[model samples]
Target: MNVYMKEQEIKTKLSAWVAGQSSGYHADSVPFDLRIIEQRIITSVQIMELILFLEHLRGEPINPMQIKPGAFSTINSIYQHFFIEGQAYA
Candidate 1:
């Protein structure tokens, strides 16, 4: 698939997974609206969790090193990292 289509697909899957994780924590903590927390507070642990979850959903092995600073900074970044850089399941 083309990059745009691939990014969209990844976004959809990531949204679902994030929603699930959010619900697991609190009913009101929607993953998409994490704006309540300052961006500076977003730790590597959280990013790593997201990376592992996405990798699991794609039936691929998780690679923490692939999730670099610019890569896991945002949802879009995650998509770019895995699809464009890591090229997992591409």
Candidate 2:
């Protein structure tokens, strides 16, 4: 897939996962730029789960050093970090 399509696919998966975190939210309701961590849409305990999910999407293990603060802060950030920057799945 091309970059935009891949990015969109990643966003959709991320949105679906994030939306599953709580009630009153749907995949379409989760904004790409939403602050998932600060807003507590994803709690601290679930952050690890999110990372694992991301790794699953990438089809490989993520490097520990690549993880940084705010990397999982939003769907956009996560996509940029793992898909664009990491380029592992691509």
Candidate 3:
């Protein structure tokens, strides 16, 4: 596959893994509007955790400074961090 396609695949896989991890903590009674708030918090935490996990998988140390603001604004952004930007886990 092309580099971009491969990156997209990685992003999708990472997003799914992150979502699955966060899903376990989700509340069933959260209203739809409040769901956005919950998701934002969870997404932020998940992104950080996912980065750590990726770093671990790649046998590297976590670099908190490298995680830019808005880096995890969207799932696509997280993918870009790893594949397009070559940030990997560390």
Candidate 4:
């Protein structure tokens, strides 16, 4: 896994993407624990866009079989499941 990207950098990019998904948010102000999907901060269709963003960030394709809805529930969970070592419970 060439997941050598710094965690902060990854989170920054992720935050920017999520913030851009909404009109009233900013990258730095995006709450890590916010239930974006559940709150409709990001639309259902945007979920696929999020996945694609993550894939581009991680430089790899996420295994569809290993994905769970909980992994996409929030910014923090998404980072934990995809970028962090060992925390990727998939």
Candidate 5:
């Protein structure tokens, strides 16, 4: 079967994950600013948690060397790195 995952779906999942972080803001409350970096809201612990979450979600180990500051900068940045770049499965 051909499964198509929409960008909004991906964004929703990512937004939900971000909400689980210590950002102190609801997922829906945050503006959909793709340019917002993780450093602005996410804590170090949250970033680690996000890494584990992404690894599990992608069903593969994310190489540490491949991770960049820009990778986890924003929801859209993460989406682009994992989904658009074909590094992760839906």
Candidate 6:
């Protein structure tokens, strides 16, 4: 695997995570229009779970600053934070 995941890969993994976290969603697929804020998937209980998921995916400690208001707004947003701007492990 590449040290850093491409945009689409990150999005796919994030979608999978979202699906796993939600009861009615499918783990293998996500809708193109899905948005975290609109879907309200990020409940207070999910914050730590999300952090741990990102850390595991990136193989590094995720910074607290990256967990901002719009960080988990969408799969694309999470990709940008973890892989693009934040720079996943190595």
Q: Every model's Cα RMSD, please?
A: 4.9, 2.3, 6.1, 3.7, 3.4, 3.3
lDDT of 3 by residue, 1-90 (tens): 987777655655555555566554333322222333235645556656777766754456757677666555555665556545744436
User: TM-scores for all candidates?
Assistant: 0.57, 0.88, 0.57, 0.80, 0.72, 0.75
- Evaluate model 1: give its lDDT: 0.58
Q: List per-prediction Cα lDDT, in the order shown.
A: 0.58, 0.84, 0.55, 0.77, 0.68, 0.72
Which stretches of candidate 3 lie above 4 Å from their native place? 24-38, 41-45, 56-59, 87-90
Model 2, range 1-90, lDDT digits (tens) per residue?
Answer: 987898898899999999998787987889999998888889988887887898899888886565767788899998888887876433
Which regions of candidate 1 fall more than 4 Å away from where they truly are? Answer: 1-3, 23-46, 87-90
lDDT of 6 by residue, 1-88 (tens): 6644465676777788888888888866776357866777767578678888888878889767545577777777777666677763
At residue 61, what lDDT does model 3 achieve?
73
Instruction: List, residue by residue over 1-90, the lDDT tens digit for candidate 5.
Output: 223457776677778777766457677654446444534577666777877787777777777567755777788788778767746333
Which 10 successive residues of model 6 have the least lDDT summed? Answer: 1-10
lDDT of 5: 0.68
lDDT of 4 by residue, 9-90 (tens): 6777888899998989987878878888888898869987987888887777776567765887888888888876423532
**Candidate order by lDDT, highest to lowest?**
2, 4, 6, 5, 1, 3
Better of 3 and 6 by lDDT: 6
Error of 3 at 9 (Å): 1.7
Clashing pairs in 4: none
In candidate 3, list every pair of residues with a backbone clash.
none
Q: In every candidate, how many clashes are there? A: 0, 0, 0, 0, 0, 0
Give me the runs in candidate 6 sitting further than 4 Å from their true place.
1-5, 88-90
- Residue 32 Cα positional deviation in candidate 1, in Å, after optimal superposition: 7.9
